[model samples]
Target: MTLRACGLIIFRKLHEVSAAAVGDNIEYLLLQTSYGTHHWTPPKGHVDPGEDDLQTALRETQEEAGLDASQFTILEGFKKELNYTVKGKPKTVIYWLAKMKDNSAEIRLSSEHQAFRWLALNEACKLAGYKDMQTTFREAQQFLCSQA
Candidate 1:
């Protein structure tokens, strides 16, 4: 059986910049997992039974990051699917792009993640580590840039 997961690529626009220059102001949220290789990623978790993909994304974001749905605005047009294998089993992860409603909103990480950071596009890609994750961030940055 395949393992499935979903998450939001949460970002905030820095208040120091103008709304018209969203590209310069955008910072992506990344969480550093407490376990394993201590890999960094966006808030994500396995899909619970009876939960749809989008629901799983929102729930996991709230549970892992302490940011509820009201804290951010989901971007309707951008979504990404990543396929890979874990322990010899295939896994799929879906991610939606979202912009934080308030740039000053504090991040509260659960025990699953030891730390979190808000970084610009290039720095986010470097910390994300995995090739697929890097690609995801790049695409997300591009999407936000286009919106500007």
Candidate 2:
């Protein structure tokens, strides 16, 4: 059976500087895992047996990043699913875009992650490192821009 996980592509809007810099005003959140290769990723984890994907995403986001549902708004129209192989097993991960309600909300990290950063799209993509993850961040940027 394939491994399934879910997460939120959490982002925040910076204070307006200029209309032309809309894209530059958004930043994404990434967490550096403490295990394995210590790669950075959005808050995510394996789904529990009885939990739905979105529930898992919310729960994991709270557990991993300490941002609860009240702290962010889930963007209704955007979601991404990625399929890949990990340790010879097929894995599927789903992500929904969320916008932080307050840019200054404190993040309390769980032991699963060692560090966290809120970064611009290019910086987030570079820190994420994987091609597919980079593509996901780019797509999220497009979605947010289109909505703007």
Candidate 3:
């Protein structure tokens, strides 16, 4: 059985700069897990019983990253899903695009993560460590660029 989950691919437009400079100005959010391999990921977790996929994404974002839905402009018409296996168990993760309304919102982490970062795409991909997640980041970047 697959471990199902969902999350957001959140970015800040860097109000101090322009979109042409987004390659340098954009920052992707990555959280470092406190458990297992201490893998880095976007804010996400296992789906709770009876929760809808989008609801699970929002709830996990709030619980894991201390950012509420009002703090972000959840982009419409963009979604990505990843399927993979962990420890021989299949897992599926859904992601959506969002732009932080407060570009300077301070992230407060829960016990699930040890650290967080606002990284550029390349650095984010390198730190993300897993191929699927790397592709997710790329797709998110493409989505945001299209929105620009």
| Winning candidate number (TM-score) | 2
Using TM-score as the measure, what is the rank order of every candidate, best first? 2, 1, 3
lDDT of 3 at 15: 62
Top of the candidates by lDDT: 2
RMSD to the hidden true structure, all candidates? 1.5, 1.0, 1.3
lDDT of 1 by residue, 23-58 (tens): 778889999999999999999889999999999999
Q: Give lDDT tens digits, candidate 3, residues 1-148.
A: 7899999888886666666665667898999999998988999878899999999989999999999999998889889999998789999999988889888898999999999999899999999999988998888887767666
Q: What is the TM-score of each candidate against the true structure?
A: 0.95, 0.97, 0.94
Clashes of 3: 0
Question: Residue 54 deviation, candidate 2, in Å?
Answer: 0.3
lDDT of 2 at 116: 99
**In model 2, which regions exceed 4 Å deviation?**
17-19
Model 3: what TM-score? 0.94
Q: What do the candidate models score in CA lDDT, each in turn?
A: 0.92, 0.96, 0.88
- Tens digits of per-residue lDDT, candidate 2, 1-148, equal 9999999999998886565677999999999999999999999999999999999999999999999999999998999999999999999999999999999899999999999999999999999999999999999998888877
Give the lowest summed-lDDT range of ten residues in model 1: 15-24
Q: Candidate 1's error at 84, in angstroms?
A: 0.5
Instruction: Give the range where candidate 2 is weakest over 10 consecutive residues by summed lDDT.
Output: 13-22
Better of 2 and 3 by lDDT: 2
